[model samples]
Target: MTDFWDDEQELKKNLMNVSSTIESTVATAHGFIRPILLDHVQSVGKMLRPALILITSALGEQEVTEDAIRVGSILELIHLASLVHDDIIDSAAKRRGKSTVFAKVGAKQAVLAGDFLLAKALMLTSGKERGMDSRVVSRALSRLCESELEQDAGQGDFFISHHTYLRRIAGKTASLFALSCYAGVALQESEPTRQMLCHRIGYCMGMAFQIQDDILDYAGSSSKLGKHTGNDLKCGIPTLPLIYALKQERENGQTQLHDLLYQASTPLKEKTVKQALILVESLGGVQKAQILAESYKKRAFSDIKRLAHPQVERQLSTLFTKLSTRSV
Candidate 1:
């Protein structure tokens, strides 16, 4: 298997265009919020969603077009907006090693700035080629909001089933990924089967991506992750590793972990937090979560193999493999 990034100068070029488009889009924001948005963009991550859009667009015969770049920009804006809101909700001061929007502007203006991004995304979507693409974006935005609300409601409630955790991530993270893959192919290919296949590939990959992220919360280094390990536990959010660890503890007739978790209050004691982190790791929570994430990665690879485009399949497979093991 050829390395996907090794030879795809074209894909890299498209991604560069997407980044430029994102910057230009943010630059159009009102004066008060424009600079803040620019700052947030400076610390952008891999732009995986936009990359998915461009990659899947290759499923069709057409060369990558401006429409794909434009749509990629729109998807990235929505993602950035969601992150801004998430930082506010998490009361997080840093993201990707930079001050969060909330930290820079406080919650009040941060909320409006996040909204500004969403509105701009919507405005960009309008007056373009409208059809299933637009509808998919709309539905994805709705799912993202609903999932956030659900997660918010479940905070401090560590008793949630792993199924519930999966459902939440399906909406929170997987929906945008599915939208990105579907939108790309839909723009270039009219074949429904191919479009649906790309969407499934994205969905499985996204699930694995998020599960790996949660696992990192327990097993990864704070500096590498650009945030502290066990931050999720501190926020009283029970992710896959913690959830699996709790189950194992219960099976062993142990409640120390449960007792500590149940007693977790806001501003959780540093001592208790450290203890909980130790318990989760010691009880195989991180290992169990790693296994589950690998399962999803395998599923994604299965779907990727089914794509008719061999080069695209190889690229998607390589991408999934890299993401499965990513540390940040």
Candidate 2:
């Protein structure tokens, strides 16, 4: 199948615009903070969220406006802020194959930088240039913060339920995605129904994207992932695969893996993490997680089909396939 982005060359151009806009916007930070902000911009991700915003904004309009690029930049800044904060919380040394801000500048500096980026995002959103609803962004940010806290509190709790796990991801990852989709249509004078449909598509796609990311923790190559494999377990978070594996073990009256999973307070050795990963895989955790991820992908496709524009439908279908199958 042709790549989702293959025919959408305009989306690529729009993304370039988004990147340039982000550079200028972030450069406006305090002089002391400019270098750090520019450094973070260097690791700009695949621009997946911004691309979604640009595509949905141009659905039938056939134009990715300046407002769309501006909105996309705001979304990207918010995402970067979250990553900087997450690196500190996770104590991660590297992201996208480079030392994280926290690792280079220490936690205190990283936290202030993250806060600065978040504030800039809000400031851009409220600017007279676009006048977007700050309440929308604020609500998503609130959910993101709350979910991070919930995940932290639930760490090392092996019995974390499937419902709770899903809730956490919806807040942590999917909320921002939903906001991107909403912004896509909300910027234009589109029908309310179309806007709602786009929002649902983003939420479903985000859930699937994050689930696939979690699956990569066990199945992907660390070298290609640009981070250590099984780091999530080392951090004491019982993700979907581990949760399913433990359930399978219990049904079979197994206790060894359960004992290993409960070591939330103790620092996990690399060997222990490897052993736990092995047990989770041997117990069918990977397979179960794949099935769950597929379910979310199916939901996203269903929502995509509801979009009225044939071009939008085809593009979104290709995007869904790419996201579900990509190595990264």
Candidate 3:
């Protein structure tokens, strides 16, 4: 897929500012941890959350300011921190085709490095010029923690309903998306209605973004995704596609898929994982998840139209389309 920021030069410039801020912030860490933090920051993917902040902040009457850039950088730091923790939890060795902190430094130091990022992010938030609300940041972080706990607790639970799956992702992933959107407008716009609209737009976009990611785990290639396909299955995490597949199997009075999954070990055997992948595709799980993601994309599009700026609306619409249909 084409880079979403390719056609938008100004947004690209602003994103560069966000990147610089991230690097500079990481540079302040203790010498022992600084290189690791900088390594992860260099591999930051897409800067999607920061992009959302920059995009939505344009909806307001004021020009996009340094404050927006700084806030965007802060959110990206939080996102980076979360990825560090996530890699450790999944025991993932690579991310974005680079060695994960967990793989490079091991779990203990990786955990501290991740915490340092969070602490740095929080410290940045206290700056007097910051436009983003501290309460929103804290709440989003809290939701992220709770959702992660839910997902961890639900491991090997292939029986979870689709509703349960949605809720888990809403917290795990969507909360940051929502926060990015709201922070943009809240920093620039005074109208409550517009602020709320941006929040909803972000929430829908985030939900679609995450569902598509889950779908990719079952249907995408490792080279394209920058990680192994079927990694989620190997880790025994029941994402939407697998959840739907199990539901379909139950309807047909078939337990083959369930039995395969149940018998599979953590970091499931490759052969069994292959079998499970085929069963999931044949049962239409990937297609169903795609449909759900498309629905969210459409909802976000509808709201994007409600915004007054034609340029911002088109940019957002293009982003939503690319995100929903992305292969990587």
Candidate 4:
């Protein structure tokens, strides 16, 4: 994989700016509020969203601005808030090898902590210094809530439609990515056409990123993943790998896989999850999901190629290449 830092030195420098801004902004909080907010911020995993803002702005041959930093920080806070809430819902024990807030503080406090983060993000985005339109951020947040509720509603079914799955991911993960790049370009470029292009590029990358994550849940190990493999299956969530495997089973006139998954029990046991993982691989679910991810990556590259700056386009292309094959 390409080294993102060595290849894009300038973007990496700007990303440091974003990181500093996040730390300083959160430091303004006092007492109990500081710890709750800083816990995740202090140990973040992959600042992908902010990097997107900086990279997309660079694609327009523009320097990263204060507005970009402000919006990037706000978006990262929102992303962290979503992770906190997701951990609660998934009953996750560890995140990036540390005790999750939900694991340490219990669900009630975790939920409130997540809400506080969202509130802080909202305040920042709405403040006069934010420069960009607040309505866009508001809509993205609403979509995120709706997608979380949709995922909640779909739980325990074991078989979700592809359309439903796509819509859920679009709202849950892709919306913020799209918003980040759009807001980044919004600060530097006035051309509505270019803004829309950046939005599409980010959307494609986010979708590909989530698909890769779901694939890892089936194909990765605890040491590499920083959490137990097959946790999604244990939690009764149907991701793309399981979705594709189930379809193959039905097409092959095989009922054993279906019975093992849906008819065996509720909240799948570890043994059942292991069996499902084996069956998914045996049925080529992993390969199919990989192909799907590649498709989204190609879509992102299509837009990246359309950018006017050849060097910036090459940088983004290389960045996505690293993202596509990332292990964690």
Candidate 5:
């Protein structure tokens, strides 16, 4: 299957289309946080999750339904809204190479903007008071918020276990992704088998996607990621890669790295940070993480065979390959 970059132009075009649709939905100003929120929402991004939802929907039905579009759009809108809030917590200055709403309008304004987006999303999902998916989706959004709050509260706690980190990220990141794909399936079929397959596949894919994100945050640059590199590290969050390295360290490697990490939130010296990174890289942390991600992709794909065949299922299948090797 072709990778994401192999079809980079196609992906970009699809993203632009999704962005345009979302803007049309939420671009109006009720005098509160009008253009500021709109401009930030219009910033360039991959829009990969929504695209997956749509593709998975197509797998079940021959034609796209209005329900599918609305569901896909709402899923993405909620995800983006969460991002707006997350940037505030992380003190992120930029996203998609544009000044973040938090940077542009201050944290207070940014919070309002995020609230506005979320409120708008809720209204749309409510669908003129007869909203189709409001109940399930509202519950999902609440879960996502709780997950993020947990992660935020625990970010600085040195005692948080790896399992805690995994659960937190799964809720914060993978839950939305899972719902995106699950909603697609939900819209088309209520068959237990279909729903089960979609959930399992989406959950595993979400896990892999978040891990790759952790890997890139450390290994990639701002231009490629469209944000500050090592933001997580700087925030004193010992992510999987660093955590893995620390776990696998030789006696001295463990002591030195742990000491460097345990110190309260000072900017890790450049030389010291580089050594830690090198240690992580040497201990097979990056490789091990990739292996775990690949296992998720493999497990996700393994469930695909259980579903009835459709021609467009290929695109859904391609998503696994594309995500595994995507560059940006």
Candidate 6:
């Protein structure tokens, strides 16, 4: 099969317009939000969710012929809101190379902005009706928030078990991906089977995407990875690869690894990060994570098969490959 990762070239240009809207939405993000919404945490962000929704919406149609943009905007609002609140919780400074609102505007304003965006997103998701679509979107949003809370409460142990780490990221990140794809199908008057396929496939691919992110943080360059390469470690996040690697070590070995990791914290030092990377690779942790991601990629392709037309289908196929391999 032809590689899909590089195929995003055209899609990127097409979605450039959509991203522009997202940029505008984020700039005005604090305007409609509560008084607490401020500038530090508010700015245009990468329209990742919107793009995902739009692309998925395009699945059964030609070009951007469908109402994918509306669905994309709706998801983008929710995503921006989530990031606002998440940055506060994570005490993060930079997002997409800019200072996060929470770090600049103060937590209270940043948090309220998040709430405001979420409220708007609620209405957007409702559209003309407040029936199944509202319920589905609401439930997914709630789950996504709960996932954040779970991770916040987590100990961030390097030796943390693999299953829990998967759950956290999947819930926080994958849930939104699934919701966007589900909404894409719902709005398009697509088949129920196709809707189900989009949701499952998106979820699987999202999981792979998150896992790949974790791997690259340790494996890629500071410039290429952007932000901090081991930001996950900085946040005390123990992603799947690290967790699995720790599990494979002996009890004393696990203890030593955990000590080394926590003492270093996330975006860990280059030398220390290198040592851990070597350790994880030695134990097949990186391979295990890659294998899991690849499985999801295959599952995504299977789901794409449920949709009709070769062009759109091929586009989705290419996106999944790129998502799994992208540098950042």
Q: Highest lDDT: give the candidate number.
A: 3
Q: Give Cα-based local distance difference scores for all models.
A: 0.84, 0.82, 0.86, 0.81, 0.70, 0.68
Clashes of each: 0, 0, 0, 0, 0, 7
lDDT (Cα) of model 5: 0.70
Give per-residue CA lDDT, model 6, range 146-242, as digits (tens). Answer: 8889887774556666777788877889988888777666666677777777788779878888888878866767765447766666667678778
What's the TM for model 1? Answer: 0.95
Q: Where does the lowest 10-residue lDDT sum fall in candidate 1? A: 1-10
**Candidate 1 residues 175-233, lDDT tens each?**
99999888888888558888888888889899889999998888888898888888888
TM-score of each: 0.95, 0.93, 0.96, 0.93, 0.87, 0.81
Q: Which residue runs of candidate 5 sit more than 4 Å off their true CA positions?
A: 1-17, 30-32, 61-64, 126-139, 250-253, 266-272
- Give the better candidate number (2 or 5) by lDDT: 2
Error of 6 at 54 (Å): 2.4
User: Hey, what RMSD does candidate 3 come out at?
Assistant: 1.8
Where in model 2 is the C-alpha error above 4 Å?
1-7, 60-64, 127-135, 264-266
- lDDT digits (tens) for residues 234-325 of candidate 2: 87777899889988999999988888766535346888899999999999998999999999888889888888778778877887898899
Q: List the candidates ranked by TM-score, beginning with the highest.
A: 3, 1, 2, 4, 5, 6
What TM-score does structure 5 among the candidates reach? Answer: 0.87
- Model 5 Cα lDDT, one tens digit per residue, 31-76: 6467777887776365767776666665554454556666666677
Regarding lDDT, does 1 or 3 come out ahead? 3
- Residue-level error in angstroms, candidate 1, position 51: 0.3
